[model samples]
Target: MGPTGDGGGDGAGLVVIIVLAAAAVVSLLVAFGYYCYIRNKVSKHLNKLKRNNEALEKARSAVEEEEEGEVGPTVVTERGVQVFGFKQLHSATGGFAKANVVGNGSFGSVYRGVLPEGRKVAVKLMDRAGKQGDEEFKMEVELLTRLRCPHLLGLVGYCSDNGHRLLVYEYMANGGLQEHLYPDGGSCGGVSKLDWETRMRIALEAAKGLEYLHEHVNPPVIHRDFKSSNILLDRNFHAKVSDFGLAKLGSDKAGGHVSTRVLGTQGYVAPE
Candidate 1:
């Protein structure tokens, strides 16, 4: 009887050992599955963050370019038609190089660039973010395409690409009237003397240009931001109005007096 009892006790101990071994194997499989799940989740989250960062960087670059007055390729004249190539303008302006900047205004920066054809031109760069700029670019193209007058600033051409808007014009040798009137590091009290005859001629010539904009065109144009700075002169001192960013066409058809948020240089702005 004692021998039979010992054998049964040994058999029971063996069964218990097998049960524990099976439980250990099950635990290991469960742990491995959980680890895989966590690893996949972490990988997915990291990828998402990377994509978001790239998008944010692109947005920041666009804003910075606009604020700093940096623009992309400008348009220019090719024969009688307005034309521009991404590669050509890029090379001409030294990749819109910062060193080429000659002037700046409310609209954008002016770069003095030499074309592939060896023509010197003034490139006016505009901000792509603002609706005001977009409207100005469209209006200039449409209005200039239709009108032809010597007193007005000639639009050689324009470029609309890569979120950049630019206007190209024949470079003025003498620069704008404001530059002559208000030389840097000089007191305004001693502004450059404009003789009576010269001033009178300028007034008349500009008046005729305004008359053309107001009376002759199918839809009258109003130069909202008229100032000495906008009055550019060539080598012969011939006056032609520049900076049409605030110019509007068809003032007659505009709704309810069309009030604009105040624009132009402080001293040059017209009183409402």
Candidate 2:
């Protein structure tokens, strides 16, 4: 009888040991996933000055090429990005009327415009001041024109005429994810509360966009300004990643690592 009691105690202790081992394994898997996520965040942020300086050079070269009307595949003119006539966009937006305005930000405003061909497009008009919004404009022009990820926002065209800067993209009917996620308690665009299934689907689509950038692209771009606001949705609630303004260009030389201060939204940056 005493031996049987001892055996039962041993069995109970074995069960506890197994449970502890299982918990340790789960913890390790969770840690590894987080590590991968941080790695995909492009590792380190580049110093503001360096980023700006390099951006200036890139934007300068691109602008110069556009100005010169260079041909062949090397020039942006020959690339997929169409050079929209400033007057056309001006007319489309009804002289940049406030009524057509759909969104506004530090760089400029976004207007819902209808192309002359009856195609609906979103036109981003950057208030050109001290070369203020040129870097972001050029970045989108350069990157979006080259990268063809389906989950990424499509650049329909752009206007860089007479010192005016405008970016035209395929209109996202549903607007940004942020709008739906946190409504103003009035005119909530999407369902009052996004069901778990819908939320998971949006997350999956966004991840696909990031995965394409992280693995498929030649140099592997890193979106430093990743957030819900940048994730736009279509009429069918399909998500597409937008806003390549603050993304990092990770080349072979850089090895996806840079040196500098932390960047991104206050609450969203590496909160691990």
> Highest lDDT: which candidate?
2
Q: Write the per-residue lDDT of candidate 1 for residues 1-272, one digit (tens) a residue.
A: 99999999999999999998899989998999999999999999999999999999987886676444454433334334365544456667787789988778667788888876788888877764678778888877777766778889887777776777877888888777777777673545456766778777777877778888888876687787787777888877788887666777665664536555776677777677
Give lDDT tens digits, candidate 2, residues 1-272: 99999999999999999999999999999999999988766544445667889999988887676456442123246677667667778778788899988788777899998876788889999885765378888888889999998899999888888889999999999999888887773454545466788889899999999999988887888888888889999998899999887777776454557554566677779865
Off by over 4 Å in 2: 1-77, 185-191, 253-256
Can you tell me which runs of candidate 1 are displaced by over 4 Å? 1-80, 185-193, 251-262
The all-Cα superposition gives candidate 2 an RMSD in Å to the true structure of 27.9
| Model 1 worst lDDT window (10 residues) | 72-81
TM-score for predicted model 1 compared with the true structure:
0.63
TM-scores of the candidates in the order shown: 0.63, 0.66
After superposition on all C-alphas, the RMSD of every candidate to the true structure, in Å, is: 15.7, 27.9
